[model samples]
Target: MKDHLSALVQKANLGDREALEQVLLKIKDLVYNLSLKMLLFPEDAKDATQEILIKVVTHLSTFNHKSQFKTWVYRIATNYLLNHKGKRSKEFAMPFKDYTDLIDLGHSNEVRYTKNEGELSLLEEEVKVSCTQGLLLCLNEIDRMVYILTDILGFNGVEGSEILGISSENYRQKLSRSRAKVRSFLNNKCGLVNPENPCRCTKKIDFLIDQKIVNPKDLRFAHFSDRSIDLVGRIDDLEKSVAIYRSTPNFPAPEELLEEIKTTLKIN
Candidate 1:
């Protein structure tokens, strides 16, 4: 597949539309699924998907093929979303800061850092899940991009460092401290503030708040109970999780829209 992508990219760069179309068909789902996970909103996902298509079309000539095709495609999608700056631009976004401090990194920097490579890796996952709950509320746009690209997307520290234009060691250092901050926040929010203390909200909010990325409905003072938890979980576990995930209408794949975009861009 890698070799095929390399060939396709070379062909596309030389102005082969058929090769580009074949590559697009091969990667369409990978691109869509990634956007779905990151943006956490269907509209945003679709918009990002469309924007990625345009970018892939325009930038196809610039692909160096040093990374995998999948990686290059994902880079396009990430850049599209991160570039949308300003007021409520993220309103349509799954903006992490807008969520209640689900992960709590309070005032403490007591996060454990060891020289042991094995130990750093072993603790990384647990720390990531726990910290995201609290510190997501505090992370701004660029920070969220770096964290998501490295942690959630499974990009290597070095790869992530290059993408964010930082040294690998520096990225690793920041990642460790950021996770600590998030864990601290989550711990505090879940009412584990004091090792001897209890939660402020009931058991319900405690459970919901511990999730790495919770919905906006629960964050805005809307209470969810045990039954609601079960309901939400069951719905997710359903065989049709993708089919009924949202209550909103799907945007039409209108020809006029495509024609408008194509005519404006002068891409036959």
Candidate 2:
């Protein structure tokens, strides 16, 4: 597969439009999902995915094959996301203290349970995905990328270090600290992680709907499918905290975005 992808890269660099499209197709989901996790918004992720792919195509000739093609792609995606200062990133740059305060705003505001089983399921899934992304935003960009690459996406230490351009020791230390922070937050506040917590998804459904934060009619992150990171990748031993994220859906890139990217590049 690596050899095949390298051939695609070579063809793409030689201005073969079909090979360029094929290469983009291969890595589109990876770039999009990483952008989604980093930006926490589907629209923003789609835009960032397009930008990253353009960069990938522009730099196609520079790939030295010293590492796997996927790793090189990951390195590019992570570097873009790490330095990304989009509108959403600015709004989401709060520390845990601010995040806790936001959660506490709704902590005692649970409305009455009032939705059918179908709607309840969808809304709960939305809350889970949204809440998980919110929790990740509490971490700094580097630590967040480390946790996502190592824990959620199941990249090992060496791969994570390579993707982030950091030493394996530094990657491991960041992973350890990031995991502890997320675990601690989940233990204290997330009802899914600890039944003792009061922040149930069911309790937030009506409030989210009323506030236009989440719409049952237009579900964003919650798809009615069984696909998750579990089916798509490895998660090491699946520690409890990481398990919370691994169970969430592996979101796909927008259906029309790939064609748009090709058109933008003027690929015939």
Candidate 3:
């Protein structure tokens, strides 16, 4: 698979459009789901997913096979969503160890539940979506990525770390904290628990359990190797697809993306 991906990337570099298409097709679901998580709307997720493909088609020649294609694509998606959010979307970004590590956590106010007469009045369906997005907002960006990759996307810690640019150790810790926060917030909002102060996350354990439950690792890990370097290639492939599709608002020919792929080689 490494040799095949390497060759595919090389072909893409040489402007073999077919090779690029092959690569993009492989990760379409990943791109779309990631966009949905990032944008929190079906329309926006669809648009971003399509745009990510287009970007990959145009810029395949420039992708340098670094930082796991998935991570690279996510980074692009994250940046676009953060800096140029769509109409009606929130703009919640977080500062990081690397300012370049900016992530679209979405603004605090966007889609936040309306407490009408003291109760969140979203319809049954909207409630799930709203609560999910609200829960996502509470997490710091990296933690959010880890949560989505594992919880929503199913990636393992080793692979997830590559996508989010964090250590496995940190990923575990962040995931732990994020899950606790999300579960706590959900328990309160769902009327399962009170939100007055020091949270009681006890029932969450049983809830997670009754669900056939989890300590769900970041959900997107089917293809990742146990190692980080391998994860970089996966992310590199992923980034190419994302850059083309799931932008925040306006999908521009990005500048930061050029640097993301190049950095992977330095690590390799």
lDDT of 2 at 92: 61
Give per-model TM-scores.
0.53, 0.90, 0.49
Which regions in candidate 2 have their CA more than 4 angstroms from the true location?
107-114, 224-237
Error of 3 at 192 (Å): 8.8
Instruction: Give the per-residue lDDT of model 3 (tens digit) for 119-236.
Output: 2221222222333353465556566667777765667888777765668999899888777766544443432222342322222322332333122232121122132212222444
Question: How far off is model 2, as Cα RMSD?
Answer: 3.1
Worst 10 residues of 2 by lDDT: 224-233
User: Is 2 or 3 the stronger prediction by TM-score?
Assistant: 2
Clashes per candidate (backbone, < 3 Å): 14, 0, 39
**Runs of candidate 3 exceeding 4 Å displacement:** 1-8, 50-59, 62-84, 91-126, 191-268
Position 154, candidate 2: lDDT: 87
What is the model-wide C-alpha lDDT for candidate 2?
A: 0.80
In the range 59-115, model 2's lDDT, one tens digit per residue, is 889998888899999989999989886676667668898877666655334445444
Give lDDT per model, in order.
0.49, 0.80, 0.47
Q: List where candidate 1 sits over 4 angstroms from the true fold.
A: 33-38, 85-89, 92-138, 188-268
What tens-digit string does per-residue lDDT give for candidate 1 at 1-268? Answer: 8898889889878877677667766666555545544454445555666667777878887788788877777767667656644232354334344444333222222223344654333333223222322233255555656656655455788887776667888888877765565445444443323333343222222243344233323221112111121232244433221111221122233224344444544655
